[model samples]
Target: MQSSSKLFPVTLISAELRGDLSEDVYRLKPGNSPDASVELALTRLGRADRETTRGVPVVLIPGSFSNRRFWYSPKSIGLGPYLARAGYDVWIAEMRGHGLSPRNQRYKHNKVSDYVRYDLPAIADFIHEQNPQPVHWMGHSLGGIILAGALGGHYLQQTRVASVVLFGSQVSRIYWPLKVPPVEWGSRLLLKSFSVISGPRLKRGPEDEPIGLALESLRWHGLLGRFGDADKDWWAGLIDVQVPVMAVAAEGDHQDPAWACRKLMEQFGSPLREFLCLGKKQGFSSDFGHVEMLVSKQAQLEVWPLVEQWVRKSPEVAAQLAMQPDRDEASAVSADQA
Candidate 1:
């Protein structure tokens, strides 16, 4: 285990009210690891009236090659502000070297293991410090993978987390060729030669991802691989996780298909868990894509409300939804509407 003193003080960079929501951004620096000067940006959104923030704190983490903008854009149309306006205290965290968080000393050397072991705990501690209640966590794509890794590795305590929501996230986006020894070795070597996978250049998103992450992914999908890092077997540990979970996948999402997401959800040990697949066939207005599952206008109307239900409604609702076995957005819509 690492020293707790690796965490340094957090600095509040700016605070101002944005329309109905109050926005505050803070910066955190860890004293050690691959990068000492790596600063993480945590943006908090709540009602302008503090007294109205009665709901449990919720943390929204964006996926790879993304920032807080993925959760709440400049127009204030994203889910962060939506949750905040609904009376829940909302916090959106940027991974190191992304968004407002500047690149660290060893930014190119960063991996998901580093994020789970270091960054998440720091964010959790800071959030729990201010809001003592057990917080709800919602993550999209790679963000969800990182959250699950933290939970499975026991980096985050189950008692501190009220619930978890993973959107279009899975570790089983399998490429069988990567399982071959020659392919695995070649891929790893090629990835290590690059500093990052450039998001802007690739037109994938607005942020770049470290090559370290690519290398790590290669190892996980390789022939000798299981869904774990060098030091921790996160996938194996997920079977013991008991926190309430809601895993949501979209039918149109080829990046992380619904079946893989469902498999991940089924691996969890939680009794209160629900799996949601969003598509026209499932009664959603459209088959939501990876980004569209959380960001689009349709999601605002049909999806966000269900998330609110998952957050604010009784645990029994999730458990009952789980019991159906045939549950989808259609059942979720009726349940939330009911």
Candidate 2:
């Protein structure tokens, strides 16, 4: 590991025992990236004092302007810790410039393309090397978009991925006006004046987002836009991704509505895919919001258990879903809308 540090230096910054979990923090410099200053933070949680765990490796990625704390609070009682307690190798990831991951040289220029093309692959490669099994990936909001982009862009291979669970993630959000070429061009020009989007000022989240990300989005949503990057046609490429996918959306989340989420999920070529809409109408206790769907008490009881089952079942359940008769898409959509 030390010898490989020259190529990708990984430093174990901290390790502590927190209740029933052992928390370890690592700083990885996948020095291979064009940006030499890029650093990423990864948090690993396992049963305290236990050298080996029983379940498959599970990775949790938080959304834009969020951190690992999005998955678990300070009390260590969030989904990350819950999964660790359930005997899964839990890993919480913080994207570059978020949380413990400090801003890099090109931080302002960093976009989702960079995340999918560089950061995610590095993190996945490292985790795979340590765990030696196909990993189950769970991402929220922008994090899920990053995961989807990686999959569609072929930054990650099906062999390295067991399954994907997305929470309130979609690329086709209500930005139809941006589809106009002139409007997109004007929007990009305006956004270029700023280096970052101030989360505090916007009252959006805890961290700021790069203008580069905003620019990339403008182009994607622009006229003749595709869910693709310079290197790959991600939107079209999703049809080739056969891995099982679970796209979870919230009725209360106007930011990424259930309809749009379902639209994205339906595009996947995977026969073993599902769209879960959380709301009282869906038999849930409350209409879960974007953040609340994962952090709130309602989520701990209702959502986490469902996620646990998905991770535990993985390929087996996915295979079963593929073999089952297709559920009426129109009826399912109506039910979710209701």
lDDT of each candidate versus the true structure: 0.85, 0.86
lDDT for model 1 comes to: 0.85
User: What does the lDDT read for residue 222 in candidate 1?
Assistant: 83
Best by the TM-score measure: 2
> Considering summed lDDT, which 10 consecutive residues are worst modelled in model 2?
329-338
What are the TM-scores, per candidate, against the unseen true structure?
A: 0.91, 0.92
The C-alpha RMSD of each candidate to the native structure, in angstroms, is: 4.7, 2.9
RMSD of 2: 2.9
Instruction: For residues 194-299, write the lDDT of model 1, one tens digit per residue.
Output: 8999999999999999998998888889887877777789998998887888899999999999889988877787766678899988888998999999988899
List the lowest-lDDT window of 10 residues for candidate 1: 329-338
Give per-residue CA lDDT, model 2, range 1-338, as digits (tens).
45334337898888999988899898999875789899999999998856565468899999988899888789998999999988888999998999999999999999999899999999998887678788999999999999999999999988888899989999886578887778888888889999999887899888999999989888888877778788799988888888888889998998999888888877777766777889998999999999989988899999999888878776896677666667553432223421
